[model samples]
Target: MEDPARLAALETLRAVRQRDAYANLVLPQMLRDRRITGRDAALATKLTYGSARAQGLLDAVIEACSDRPLSEVDGSALDALRLGTYQLLRTRIPSHAAVASTVDLVRAELGSGIAGFVNAVLRRVAEQDEAAWVDELAPDPDTDPVGNLAFTHAHPRWIAQAFAEALGSRGEPLKLALEADDARPAVHLVARPGEVSADELAAIVGGDVAPYSPYGVHLETGAGDPGDLEPVRERLANVQDEGSQLCALALTRASLEGTDDRWLDLCAGPGGKAALLAALVGLEGGELIAVEKAPHRAELVRKLTSGLPVTVEVTDGRETGFVEGAFDRVLVDAPCTGLGALRRRPEARWRRQPADVGQLTTLQRELLTEALRLVRPGGVVAYVVCSPHLSETVGVVADVARRTGAEQLDTRTLFPEVPDLGDGPHVQLWPHLHGTDAMFCAVLRRPV
Candidate 1:
């Protein structure tokens, strides 16, 4: 009989292939919808994300055994083979059990006859040890295409080169960045300011207090059951990365001083920052407007701030039709190539390209211009991007500043509380340096 886990894995693969949906985004909802929890859900999540992240490497492995090209293979059969190969080569599971379980799954989905094919391909792949398989996948570093297809680390050559360039002179950090992408990320949480303190929430979740910020907590373990934990359900806490919380916090800290009574979060969607901002705004007795483009995402923002004072509006950040100089402060969390949060979004490296950055820079400039237009003359506009690309970060701001008459503020002075965040024209946090997402925050002001 086919195992339920294998059925879940095959379903995840089907969804990813057909819908272009992210494994992380799709799997959780599926699991919840099916009422699968604990170990089953965890296993399904692992198989889906792991296979997606290692798709290129898995394809190479599958290609070596099959006479026909991978594209020619039936999608279901190929995915079954991938699940088998992942267990045999990458995981610590027993080889026989892995092969047997996968073959059973193939028989159930495809046919009894197809099981033989899966068994043959998986056996060949399993015969080799991990090191040998890695060598097989790894390309010759000296050659052109082979050199470009180095699979020892499983990241594309262009991405690896970009990491090296961004980390400059520090070769170890670049390697670590690649390794971090492969490793399981920690579950982080943000404490809503008045609803709960970081210390109190940390005690509830059994997490250690986050080192950098008062409102952040890094849970060492116990991410499995946020619902069971009463503190989380009370809306006093949320599952969010400390790094993201820090970026949002840094923005409020930079501009919230000297009484910017009203706040705006342009391009707020799925509302993680908006949640934190709503709490902060409530504390200050200020008004907040979270403008999101999509109806579903705007509804999500509203759901996140259900009982809170923040207002969620379904509208474009570029042309929300708000009066000029209406808000005292605005956060233009412009959408760009999400290079900074790649570690969390495992399959992102494969999906992203150099061309995407150039395209995003155009959108970033437009968003920044609109954000600045809405801010009161002396009010602050903190232009933020969850990416470190020069074009998206510096270039967008530079171009917008030239046209809008906006002046850059001392970023270092504004976020002096963040350690190693020295005084500068803008703040660019690095994955290698801060052990956080590569978020860029540039605080600019319109001349009165």
Candidate 2:
């Protein structure tokens, strides 16, 4: 009999390979449906996400052991080998059990014809030390720096070069970024402004406390179960990145002071920021209307901040009839290539291609063009992305600002604590510079 957790893990990887599904998206639901819990749930998540993230390295190890090309191997066997190799290289599971269980999984899935092949290959893989295998896989640094970095660090070659070019120093920043991607992401939470203060929620999460903004926490030890925590389930808190919380807070700080107004979250969906903004604006006795294109996602936004003051609508922000100069502030947290969130979304690093950026930029520009009419004269419109890609971040904002008359405001005036937030009309935060998510924000004030 096979461990159900391991079987689920294998099945999840198969889904990712055959269906072009995302591991992060599929695994949570799978785990819930099966009622996998505690250590089993955690290990399942690790096996699924880690195997996906380190597939390139696992491929190298598998290829070294096999006589045939990886493409020639049965898909199920390949995934089984990858999962077994992932355990050996990336996890502390007992080596024999890892190999044996994976072989069993392969035999069960692909029939007995390939079981011996699976066993033989995985046995050879387990026989050699990981360091030796890594050396064999690592490209010569002098001859193929990009390939070397990609293979050794388990990154796509183009992505490795992108980070190298973006970092410029090249001394160690790229390696550090790659290392960060391998680590488990810290759980970040947001306190609903009207319902919970930062101090109250911080105590529950055992995180650092802060006063204003109603959004600060730095849980060190025992991050613990969020659901078991009181504030979160009570609708007084929600999970969100500190960077995203900062972005929403910056908008509130940069908004026109002394005005009771209507605000629009132009591209709100999976509504983390929209919910946080709603709490702030609502506490101030202002209206925050969030517009999401999909009805299902709009319903998620509604459920996420159920008790908070917010109006969720199912409509496309880009084409939604903007009451000419109707809103005091509008936040276009526009869609873009989600390159910045690689650490959180493991499959994203592989799933995204360079071409996706081009398509996303076009949508981003269209949304920005329409967002101009949504904000009132002398009001502010904050354009933000979870990415710091040049084309989507600065290029789109600059293009819209040039076409429209909106003037860029100093971003540091809003997030002074963020050092790389920089002294410019806009701000771009890097994961290397700030522990926060790589995000870009541009505040453009419509002339009064």
lDDT of each: 0.77, 0.79
Query: What lDDT is reached at residue 255 by model 1?
Result: 48
lDDT of 1 by residue, 73-180 (tens): 888888888888888878888999989998988887689888888888888988886578767667654564323333655676666665555545224565566666
| TM-score for each predicted model, relative to the true structure | 0.90, 0.91
Model 1, runs deviating above 4 Å? 142-150, 225-228, 255-259, 412-424, 430-432
lDDT, candidate 2, 1-448, per-residue tens: 8487788888889998999988877887887788887878778888888888888888989998999999899888888888899898878898999988988888777888899999999889988766788778798877876667677778777777766665563447777766665566666778777666788788766777632234866554224345556777777787777777777777778857546468889888998898888887887788788999999999888988676678887888877875788888889999887767777777677788888888999999999878887787888888899886778888898999999988998887898566655557787766666666677888888877
lDDT of 1: 0.77
Clashing pairs in 2: 208-218
Q: Supply candidate 1's per-residue lDDT for 326.
A: 90
In model 2, what lDDT does residue 67 have?
91
Winning model by TM-score: 2
lDDT of 1 at 295: 97
The clash numbers for all candidates, in the given order, read: 1, 1
Where model 2 places Cα greater than 4 Å from the true spot, the runs are 127-131, 206-214, 218-230, 255-260
